[model samples]
Target: MKQARSFDELRALSGNWLSREALPAWIENGYDQRLELFHERLSFSAQPLSDLPRRLMVQCRQLYVLAQLTCRGMRDDRALIAQTWESVKRYFYRPALSHRWAFSIDPDGDVADPRCDTYTLAFLLFTLAWLYRVQPNQDYLDRVDEVLTLLDGPLAASSHGLIDAVPRPDGFLRQNPHMHLLEAFLELHESTGRADYLDRACALHALFSSRMLWRAQEALPELHDDDWQPARPDDNWYEPGHHFEWVWLLRRLSKATGIDVDQDVRLLLSRAIAEGIDAEGFAIERVGIHNQSAWNSRRLWGTCEYLKACAAEAEAAPSESEAWRSRANSALAAIHDHFLQTAYHGLWNDRLDADGSRLSADVPASSLYHLVLAIMECERVFGRVVPPSRPEPGRMRALFLDRDGVINVDTGYPRKPADITFVEGAMEAIQQAQTYGYRVVVVSNQSAIARAYATEAEVMQLHSWMAKQLEAQGAVVDAWYHCPFHHEAQNPVYLHPDHFDRKPNPGMILRAAQDLNIDLTRSQMIGDNPSDVEAARRAGVSGHLFTGGNLALFAREVLMPRPISEASK
Candidate 1:
């Protein structure tokens, strides 16, 4: 089977799309040439829908979306960001209404929704954070402080957190805005490394932990009462994408603070991966918090969120990276297959139905932020991806083992199938090696044929039988090698002064590399004797001695599942 692209390779690949195609396409066509604000959606024909009301959320998302590309050094559009920030000021920033930003603007550039929602406010702060990162202007700093004062004074919630929105609706308040506020605070903290930003994050995180992060339901509730109590089970639902998004957010927060959130992260990740991602690999939009049922609607951004979560998990826990990175690669593939392509180049379909049919024809420009952030995180974790090529089969690593002592009880070269006794942890060790991307190859010094204790055919038959038994037990040995020739041989055909294939020489390992297309440098060997170590040295592979213990435990240590204690840092 063909190996998937490595995480770095994915980053590079996606980075190209973001820089060369997607961002540029959006720059030229996604923005309203006349209005200067980003259009909320683009038609399938690649035309911007200009008549729709402009949202503060879309403006901030677009500002951040454009600035991120420049921040990553993919493009240098400082002048463009500055120009857009000017428009952001002219359109969204309200001077008359206590300096609170307007929620939306009509086509005539008049304030359509005066009541500033927390979602819009959070995104505006997120934009300012990026704006400051690109260029630390005094005005941007002043604006951030002003927004913070308003949030703490007027928009503040009943006790601690901010209200869902001003002109508080009789409807249940939302957890979505708080999630975004947490995200905004994290961005600010990361950009400035200020204690105040971290403090803000801590408060929001505390609110999330106490209220929205529902451990019992294995999902965060989307709706809550004004007092921060979760909505009734019957009316409550959650987005699996948010679950994935939080995994990345939590990991970032842990980096800023020395707090350990590994357990919580793992729990949220496990539940989302299990229940959120469907059989086809798409992240479903909504799941009933009460019934644990999912909606058929799937968004392109959700798949990107899944990629972000997996990448974060992989970075946080190196030992478990194989599992997490594999999922990340899967998410990328799903993205490439479905969302990244369009009728127009660099444009994407935002939503899909159960059968992968386009549910929404218009692309929401807000989603570009999600997709780009996912690739950016991958680059941060795995390094920037570059051009991809087919993985050479010969470059694959293997776990080479001495058959008798390593895989089974060493019973003095007993050749009969009935004499075989598999070593404890041997089968599990083989499985574990494969889980970590190593092929298991067995090389045995079967000198019994030379001693005339067993015929060559009999030993070959025993090996075949043992392989079958191992396969049945889920321990698949990929290839096998045996040396029939020996120095002192009773059988004339097997007699040799010095057989090159014998241990303490590199012949068997070299032959295995040639026959099985193995990469010797990356491969490892485990045997009970010093000769095995010497043979591995000659073969240019690392060799480990297996003492009397569970084979699985010994191999695990050799594999080096290093804890990522400072991975975030």
Candidate 2:
């Protein structure tokens, strides 16, 4: 397969492959008619028709995939997702156990494993969160609250932050469940905007950093003792896949909670790529503390995790973004060549031997969730689709201006509000833009905060003062965005070499589009720097250079329609 040269190409290729080819094949071959849900496995010769005990994790995972598809503009799956949810409610949820979900259910609709598993519960919450996002229902929210209550009460172990697998000490502990718990909390917070969910997620992140992650070796041990320590310190086992997974999760957490985990994320990705990946670009399953191969087999899901880690690293490290993007493309190529070479379109080899022979004969439905997530990350990083809480559809235009030179004089490091002075005719330009039905906004790069020359509070104060000054002249400034990041920043907290929100990254502009409901294609950005223009280009918007002189004249000339030849001239 040919490699993708740009993010747009990558997004188009990935999205189309999933939506047009892979997903349809899954729906056609993965569904079990008698069970009224997805089949556990589909062998090349025959489909399993027997009603066997299926894990609740599988059911929830399938439901989550269908719900995500529906949320992403595939409206045809809504009915199917709803029906699957009904099956989950009927078979998986045990009303006798305080409405706790069973671990697995038999063919006769009996609870095969009545034990309440923390990992299974996390997936249930995650599915419910996505279902609630697609179709807002009070019932789902109530169930979420009830599940949280049970998890905190009856299922809670003596350990402060740990939940039991079977409401008793089975001498088992794993960080996998906590990882999914964090994912669920973040999804809940996204759908509901609940501070409590964010608080819970923060706690899980703390657990990961302190207990789960072995900082000395830069590894995340899979098995843990009851006290949350590694089961065997001398011969510890780690999965490169888990490290890759944590890399992406930590980046998400840092963005959501304002925590700085860049150093840790970098370390994890670097080590995972260096030691976990084979020479053939496949991600191996398990390794020891000394980087010895424990399980030499490569799994499909492991490759997916490696791809996602590369995507996340690309976004975080701009200087090396191309290298990371290339790595992602290489992983994708490996998946296509080794896993998807079967006669069936969507049927992928789940595992491969060390020499690259297929180990599994049947296709499992659980792997779809992993592939979908990796594709979704590609879509998000490439700006193919807006975020889940997208702006309402409209044709509203906006005028984005840079503050330092466009709005005010380019006085370097203006810390005090008293030193602020508006450029000539800048106030008139703002009023005129509003008169022409355009939202006026300011987007600036403030490395001063990173350099410790000014505090964020001081910058906000200056913006407020500037807004007040504009209000006196019957003008308005709709919103303000600034980046306080620099690679060589003096302040440790603000030093980010590849900060996504910095100029030339387009994060602030994209965020403004989401928050203000601005039509980026119709909007225009005015700045004095080339980086500003590049940022607008990346955001899929038009950018204009402001080379001084009357701001009102520049605004009028740009906003007004002119003849093609005259305008070009």
Candidate 3:
């Protein structure tokens, strides 16, 4: 096994200017074009960006849709979300007069091609399903129904039950489309609680594992010909992004079905890091058999996806999955030091080398949300403190909670410092957790960063004042993680997509986990929103959905269930 690299090694090789030179290009160029295609109003074309072909285009859209859905779920960004949804309808939906103006015909419609490929349809449906869940619009639901109807019509899957590319007579089912469809169907299943969606998702999962995944080689086959055979193993090497997507889905499926695909999952995940990842945690887009320049390619989206995967695996398998946890942390740190800029407070596009010596400098528009979600997931897995609801037997890691609405007063996205008010028992609940001897950590998601209503630094100032007030009452927060990304707001540095440091994205929790070396699975998380609960779940943490209680009372009820201290073996 390759040992993880140290920070010193990274610094020595890249020199000091690596981040300065490479970050700007990555930020300006990476994921934005795709974001503009899906979310922003484009004066350019009705079709989606043509730079990538149809298959990759659909995959990119699906990835973006997933990111947007997660963002909407975490925070309340309804107005701009609605505007973006309208554009999605115009571009991807049917029954409109422009429906006849297919992308393949004149290259002037929503997607680049007038002809709707099976991959395109699947991802489009997936996006529609997520939008429906968030906004609950009848129009969006109806559109989803219509698309499903057409999907049943022309784009039938092969006997293997995999959706076939409509125009192609090939049996080749690509992993990218199948993965999104699985996610889309899983979302539908969750929203509607239908067995059919779950069943379909399961079948797609099986198809991907049996056919698309190469077990012997421990890698994923990127492309295939008409037959379900590998067209080019060397050419088919993919980055860790797709691998991580699969890992997350597989873990979720394992929990849902009580069946484990862990062995296959590990093989694919390890191969991704070992093969695709270079020494300094830079995930190369493409790699050749030997160190050949012909396949020397790199991109930013790949790195973003890899981090998400790492965060996901860390949550799902942190205990027995040391390799995954360590590498994931290493990759995240690399991204932070290299791609993340102090100037923009967001990630750069891509890197020039494995050591992250050359910053690609441009940030891809699509990468903003992807990076945000990644961090949230990471924090969810890593951040949490024990509450007073459960009494600790001994000295334990106590979860320090900020006593706003989190412990009590639900002011609903407190905009002003004047709006700061305490909920009853909030302080007592935290004190209870502390009384039980748990090491306390505080995790909170603040959207004011996006609103430009306040700076994160200012929020910190308010939090510091609040902490003093809490300490006066015998409730002390040990450490705090506050997220400041607001897509709608107008801040130069704090606005837009960010890394894992944000809540609802687990950067803060994960950082706490690393800094404190707390056993996350044994840890506890308490937050006001379902996002907090999800973050806890993502972190493999036991979490409580709380409101209006004494911190001690809640702690006694919640944290007492599990033993606070584990015997060191």
Candidate 4:
């Protein structure tokens, strides 16, 4: 058997593939330029299935994806996005139904399903939230308010917090709608910072924890009673995809509320990974509480959820970050091998049989939302830009400086704010570099925390004081990165050999580059230590040794009419 790649490796591979291959493929086949909307489905050969109705939900999803791409600097399709928005408003929204959008419409501009459901409306809210974020519009906000009013008035059940689909009850209360509603509310809260949106999301989250999740098996059911209890028996049916989805959502909720739900997150992820994933590495559609297969079908969205959960868990749990990342890699590999098509670059096999054979040949537009979100998460985790920028990307050039020796006078683990002293002309050097369009970032190795000489808090305080001093000099540091670990430390908690984030490993530099959008090739690291030089080398950036000299003179020499690499050489 071949050895599997790590999570970081997998994230890079899948993220690159999505950006380089899948996104363009989507634009070519999935989107219909003539219709000014995404097609309902695409055949395996990347041809649109025009026979199907264009769903309002699908339209909203594609809009959201496109808006997200635009925000991430992936695509510049604002004209198309604006055109699609007009198409949606002109065709889908019904003035008679109090501005409620129809569920689906035929390509001939006729309504297919006019009944407005909470599911479709939730997606609308989600899309509008992104649209508002991309281009803030009072019109989108008004639409959000109108929909919320409709949901609260005519569509709401007599029972508080329960919403029935307009025109009639569906006879089945599904948790899926509520999940999306939570997602929408979260997005709205993030965009507008309205306390009400967050409050609404909190209520739904409370319901999810109290009623939707089966206490006995810790499984979230697909169907629920009108009272929000599980409709099925404990061993009857459960969705692995929902489990992963909930894991990501719950983590988001916890982050927003500052509530500690780490245990629940861990349990959900553990159960889903153990029971939900089949031998082929696909996230199976439905599984019983006992980990038995119920519905053996696998969907692309499920794997996307799985990848998201893995990324979330990896971020939350540092001790097991590698393991979670590895699981994420496995899921991505499965997606690439099974779901992605070789002939059609961006198209995916939406459904697969238990034996890993393709079941659905049509690429649904809704799945694009899932794929884009997963790719974003991957970029966030791996610190890479999705859909790499072209034609002079907007990444900044950085000057990474070590704090102890390069910025402040090194008096051996100086942690007190009073012990800070700038090197000769350091302030002028930083100002001059900033004037020349370079982001000045400080990367420091603080082993004193591990050695018990100083606490991390004290180190941060010192940095803050240093920043204030620099601000007085009209120079500012863009970011500060520090590694507080040692291979051989008396503190067991801080002891770790070959710590990737410590100096010489380039973890700090790499992370800074990712977070700050710094171009490593054009960046440079200045330090008095060999470890700093090695870190710069590993990060693929040039390194300059700082001896006792005027810092402003060095800055001019380094930033002269030559490549930093050549000048350094």
Candidate 5:
């Protein structure tokens, strides 16, 4: 397969078929045909509960695949996006609220297990950040900040790495969660420009590059003790997905930092491809570094992530990027051919023999999402580009958002929609930005929710109301992220932990960047408070702090053509 020069060429090549439409070609044409190959074989032996984290992680990956898929075709499917977002949020937020049920049922909160896994938390943070992009909710922003603060308090180490990757109560360590943490932080850093967030991202990048990547074997050490010393190198015991996944992250870091990461990406990706690739064009599931034959069944997620990594490499080093991209495309082509059957178009957890023969199949929804994201990324970067439905001029947007005094009447910790009031010209300012193709993102903080002054539900309702009201005025927010945790509050929810997402923290602004896919280095943040200025500074957003002046006037003045007219030239 040749690399696509444009998205149009990509569309023509793929024949514009959705993965579902393309799956039958995989079944009738490809190899692997075992009935029970993809799904885990049900045996008489009782399944271990400890495997929950791994299972959950897989589920999260699949959800990502679905999101990518659903998001691809719809330019106006707001309802579909909202529903899918709620489904993913159910996994994260439901568990978060589980504590309340424990307190109610036992009256003493004696359930012992909090259902909080480090892997779960890390995954949750990633999802939350993603959700904010699609939905642009402030409550999600607060939740992300809240969750990370909790993790830092319990999982962070003075030695500059997260504690051995364990969920609550055990205090153990693991590589998967740390890797996820690095991924989530990198996302957060890109969304907002807080040095601390970037610093954390760099620190984790260093930790993984220097400490996790096996120097001699050019592989990742699966298990680590509390101090991060490798407990084992046996690949069978760990999934191969992480290695491929890390390749993508490393490449993303390299791209964001403008640093030469070809060597690192090549080192990791080449090893994965060499060890995992098969004659069938699909990579093997698990392979021992030295054993040469301890491979597990090639699974859907491993292949999808490997392709994702390849795509990332393609993006990072375009010159030689095609080699990896070709391998990934081949792997995905093989997967679609062999794994998918006529009954289902999604992924199957079919077990494959070492020779790439399928033994069984269980189409898991979780694996579906990663493939969706991988394909989506490929499409966005290389797929055909039709003229947009609406033609608009791009603007260097300095989102002149009116906080409390400008958009809504500043009710301290506004608890309800009834309390909301829009300032004059606020809607117009938002309209102006949209007209010019400047993304409109709201960067605000509501410490009142953390202060026990308001409930989470109410805070959510308030945001919902705000969005609805804004939309009513023909203004849409591309993204909105807020910090609810305040330093001082009566309620535990309100009690402020010095979090990075807060106004001064730069979290909300950063989140906007990630969600809107805006170039923060070229964007501006307009707010009313010193904290807002600081938030802009933290997020690397360039803008002016506003006061009781007219935002439209400010925008007009700021947007006026420079004295050096093109006519003069």
Candidate 6:
């Protein structure tokens, strides 16, 4: 079917729904203030399903959603995320069961399901990673060590993907939990600069490449045998949503570890796009790969996964970026038309039948994990639909680089593509900074706008192009801050004497720190000018004067150093 709305419009609608409607609804009703835990589901009217049993997986997912929002400055739920962390420990965590958390708990906070579910545990770990990223707490770090130790030991192991059920009914080896575990490990690595998490994530990627991937069918097996082979006739199915999810994860892992998994990513994405998505832009819930195509309805979370994969694919396959982007747009439309159209308030329709009917009466809280991350990926690709949040503390640290001499040679206000010349190892330095858990923020002084040589819009356009170029090279400049006003401005509108944002004043650096919640104590600024150093000093950040040579080496040797934890030990 044709796309119901343009990408910008579609994303705007989603963003508005999130900021205006869903956020308040979920925070007010979906979270139990008295109990200090998130509700398992919301009624059709957006009220909490207060009596329902709460799953540990759902609790962790909701907390993760809030943590994502906290990181984005969408909401400062750091206090709530931490408060509920304790609740999770009290309600679900079983210290008696070798410190394994229970699967589900009732409304009264009694254990509903005592199994040490691998899926729930992965989310728990995932939540911890995100929480720690928002604010580095030693407690969260220690907990991560505890969880990893438990997993690496004999208790958390399973034939496939760890143990979903404690009793291990028929020893069902599901691939889904393993996928989440990989995600958790990757995030853990990024959050803490821990090598073991990266190594563990690599191990999971190898598992996917070797056993879980159904190369003959170019698909992933929903269930695998104990021997790591696809479980046949009885389990015979493929979740197309999962194929798309794996595409995103595989590319991410490849970027992090420099592992060559793009081939597998291509294979999985190609098959999923070819057979999984219907003509209506709906991602089929399950494809009966054994010649039995029995799909009853689709899920909103599936389309969310589709959007995420499309974003990743668009980046990886530049030759076909247009097609992948088009698919992503279509996925958003599918989500808007099919799911977000519900008049009542199950955040968005969780499930829809083939004839476009809502299958469920309440919204599952667990889907927030899929939707929040999916929407963020969409924003990253299609540009942010929401407004830029104000700067505040309690955010992550950053590595702020001055643009002119550091990112590109200062050829006196270079505005055009040809005028740009990247400093040595600029890209590698950015990649390294990100790998070591720092947001790469680019702070620059663009006096060209004030001089009337280039318009503000033109300068911004160039910056956008520069950012895209850097991203294409696997070096992401997370945020950009530029001061366009100058005291000697030829244009009266741009004439501002001693503008706060100008480098020597520390305005740009300070604004960026506040906007992104960059911790100045941990952040460092790299630049070639004395003004850059002064600005860094005023902002309470360390400054490094780079006269010449490799920025990558400077970043590694001076900024990063051996301080990054070798968690492998």
- TM-score, every prediction: 0.66, 0.68, 0.58, 0.70, 0.55, 0.73
**In lDDT terms, how accurate is model 3?**
0.55
Q: What overall lDDT, based on C-alpha atoms, would model 6 receive against the true structure?
A: 0.77
Candidate 2 residue-wise lDDT, 288-328, digit = tens: 87646568799999999988888888777667867987788
lDDT of 3 by residue, 397-473 (tens): 54635334675376766655677776666667667766766667777766665566765446656666666677789
lDDT string, candidate 5, 25-106, tens digits:
2223221122101111111121212211223344344334333333332122355345544533433234545321111111
Query: What TM-score should be assigned to candidate 1?
Result: 0.66
Q: Compared with the true structure, what per-residue lDDT tens digits does model 1 show for residues 218-281?
A: 7788877767777786878888899888888888787668578876776677668778898867
Ranking by TM-score: 6, 4, 2, 1, 3, 5
Give stretches of model 1 more than 4 Å off.
1-10, 384-569
lDDT of each: 0.77, 0.76, 0.55, 0.77, 0.55, 0.77
lDDT, candidate 4, 1-569, per-residue tens? 43454444344445556656777777777777766778888777878898788889999998998787665545556787899999999889878765468888887878888887888889999999989977789999999999898778876755445564777665556778888989999889877778899999998888777777777777777766677666666446778898898888887777667767776676676667778887767799988775465688899999999988888887666668668767877788888777875576777889989887888857787887898888777656543211121122246898888888788888999988778778998999899888888888888988887787876657766776787788778887876767666887665445666565688878778766645668788988888899899989988899988886788788777765677887699
**Candidate 4 lDDT score at position 33:** 75
Selected candidate, larger lDDT, 2 vs 3: 2
RMSD of 4: 12.3
Candidate 6 C-alpha lDDT tens digits along 441-467: 888888887798886657766777888
The clash count for each model shown is: 2, 0, 89, 0, 34, 2
